[model samples]
Target: MRAIVVSEPGGPEVLEWREVPEPRPTRGEVLIEVTAAGVNRADLMQRQGLYPPPPGVSEIPGLECSGVVAEVGEDVEGFAPGDEVCALLAGGGYAERVAVPWEQVLPAPSGVTLAEAAGLPEVVCTVWSNVFMAGRLRRGETLLVHGGASGIGTCAIQMAKAFGSRVVVTAGTPEKIAYCLELGADEAINHREEDFAEKVTADVILDIMGAKYLGRNVSALNTGGRLVVIGLQGGLRGELDLGALMARRGSIISTGLRNRPVADKGVIVRGVLENVWPLVAAGAVLPIVHEVVPMADAARAHRILESGDHIGKVLLAR
Candidate 1:
């Protein structure tokens, strides 16, 4: 087996595809012969030595993958060999094979190819958990999304729209803003020129710009609003306006999926399969893929993502 190894963690150049021992399924897990993997911001962070994998997990820097099930571990049910599936992983997605807990695995969405399904797990789970489950975004309410051109952003826009929520998004350029609107966002704000806080108030704000947008995110919230921060693209430290937050009865939460327990991820995956996957199958929600690069060109994929030029996910395919 071969996987992308971040040798000494610095830049995209640090990633090296090299031979490694193949992984086998353990109890309650399954082995997937990787076909495609989703490249994410977290993978970049890991390459830069910022976000290390949780203890006892793989060092390969990928978080989601789609492949054919090669073997099923003991105690696993409802899945069998040769099933086409996609899975959320703690790590090790940038490889020819990955062993994942059965709970983290899901049947490929009906309308999408197995390769494109690689892009769905992380973004779908993130949006479903943060926007609906944790942030409590309800139908007929307004939801705000940061980085609307991103993999998470694109998925969030469609899912929120499918559930009848008004979606507003922020992006860096005019083209990106237009793309977001095309993907069902009711309004698109160019962050480079406009202050999003002055334009609209939201019932739920899904934020990726942490410190830079913290104060304004609070101001942009409607009464009893929920703000969920899942990325720190801006910075980590930010001062909170407790007075304003208290007055509005707003709540702020920061979460990460990679470090969460397998049991928790299973629950989120189950929710996604039942709720979000249907939207995807029905064409109400779709996986937005920017480009598909070969696994050996993983370094170039990282560069494209870091450049922030792509509109959606850059997938690495076998």
Candidate 2:
């Protein structure tokens, strides 16, 4: 099998296409013949030596993939060989094969192509866990999403809207703002030009570009609001006003999917399958794919992801 292997920590140029041994499924896991893998911001972080794979996980950078099940492990039920599946991974998605825990897998949504399904797992799990389980976003509440045109942002917008929340988003450009609105955001603010804190009102904030939005995000929240920070695109260090949070009874929670215990991710995957996958199948939520590149062009895929101009997920096809 040919896989994208990083020779060293550096730019996308360090990613090399090489022949590697095919992986086999272990107990409670499944070996998937990778059809497509989603490119995420975490992948870029890994390439830059910022995020390392969790202990015992593959060194490859990918975090999510969609493909057909080649084999199933012992005691794994509800799935079989040849089943179309998409899975969340701790790592190793940038290959032709990936062995993923059965609990982290979900049946591909009806009417979605294999390429598009590759973009589902990470965003779905991330949004569901943060927005609902942790953040407690509820019906009729105002929700704000940072990086509105991103894969997770787009998914969050649709899911929040589906759950009856009024969604607002922030993006870098006019085009991205329009795209977010089309994806169901009630209001879209161009973060590059406008002060999003003044333009939108929110009871819950789902943030990706963390420190950069820290002050404004706190200011934008309504009383007793919750803010969930999932990424640190604009550097991790920032200044905050404790007085504002104390006065408003505001709370800030930060989390990441990678490096978490497999058991915890398995639980998140199960919840997502039960709560979010159905919405995807019903067309209430859909994967947004910005582009599909061949697996051999993994470097190009990484470059595209780093450019930050893409409006949705970038997939690498095997």
Candidate 3:
């Protein structure tokens, strides 16, 4: 098999496609023939030596992929050879084959092509877990998402709207703001020109710019609001107004999916299959893809993600 290897951690140019040993399924795991892999900011972080895979996981940079089942390990059930599936991986998605725990693998939804399904697992799981399960975004409430045109943001907009929540977002450009509105966001604030804290209050805020937005995010929250920080695009350190947060009875949570135990990921995967996949199948929510690059040119895919010009997911296909 062939896989993308980050040799010595540097720019995207360091990614090399080379022959590698094929992986085999272990107990309770399934082996998949890779189709397409989703490119995420985390992948770039890993390439730059800022993030490393969890112990006993693969070194390849991808976090999610859509593929066909080639074999099932002992104790695996409900999935057979040749099943179309997508999975949330801890690592190793940039290869032609991946071995994943059965719990994190899901049957591809009915409406979208298998290639596009590659973009769903990471975003769907992130949104479902942080925005709904952890953040407790309820129907009729307003949810604010940072990076409105991103893969996670795009999915959040559609999913929140489908569940009867009003969605608001912040973007850096006029084009991005318009695109967010097209995806059902009720309000799109230009972060470059306007202060989001003055524009609206929200019941829940899915924030990615960790430190830069910390103080303002608290100020923008409605009473009893929830702030879930899932990314650190803006740096890691910040001071919070504890008095204000206490007055509003607000809560803050910081989380990530890549380091959780498989049992926990299983719960999130099942939640998505039960609650979110239906919306995808019914056309109420859909995956947004910006472009698909070949796996051999994985460097190009990384470059696209770093450009920040893409409206949605950038994929690497076999």
The local lDDT score (0 to 100) that residue 206 gets in candidate 3 is: 99
The whole-model C-alpha lDDT of candidate 1 against the native structure comes to 0.95
Task: Give each prediction's root-mean-square deviation over alpha carbons.
Answer: 0.6, 1.1, 0.6
Please give the lDDT score at residue 111 for candidate 2. Answer: 66
**Clash pairs of candidate 1?**
none
What's the TM-score of every candidate structure? 0.99, 0.97, 0.99
Quick one: how many clashes does candidate 2 have? 0
Candidate 3 versus the native: TM-score? 0.99
Please report the candidate that would top lDDT against the real structure: 3
Clashing pairs in 2: none
Better of 1 and 2 by TM-score: 1
Q: Write the per-residue lDDT of candidate 2 for residues 1-318, one digit (tens) a residue.
A: 889998999999999989988888999999999999999988988998988998888988799999999999997878999999999999999999999989889898886898799999999999999999899999999999988999999999999999999998888888898899888899988877889988876899998777888998999989999999998877799999999988889999998888777789989988988888788889999999899999889999999988889988999997
True lDDT of residue 288, candidate 2 = 90
**By descending lDDT, how would the candidates be arranged?**
3, 1, 2
Off by over 4 Å in 2: none
State the C-alpha lDDT per candidate. 0.95, 0.91, 0.96
Tens digits of per-residue lDDT for model 3, 62-132: 99999999999999978999999999999999999999999999999989999999999999999999999
Writing each residue's lDDT as its tens digit, candidate 1 over 18-118 gives: 99989989899999999999999999999999999999999998999999999999999779999999999999999999999999999988999999999
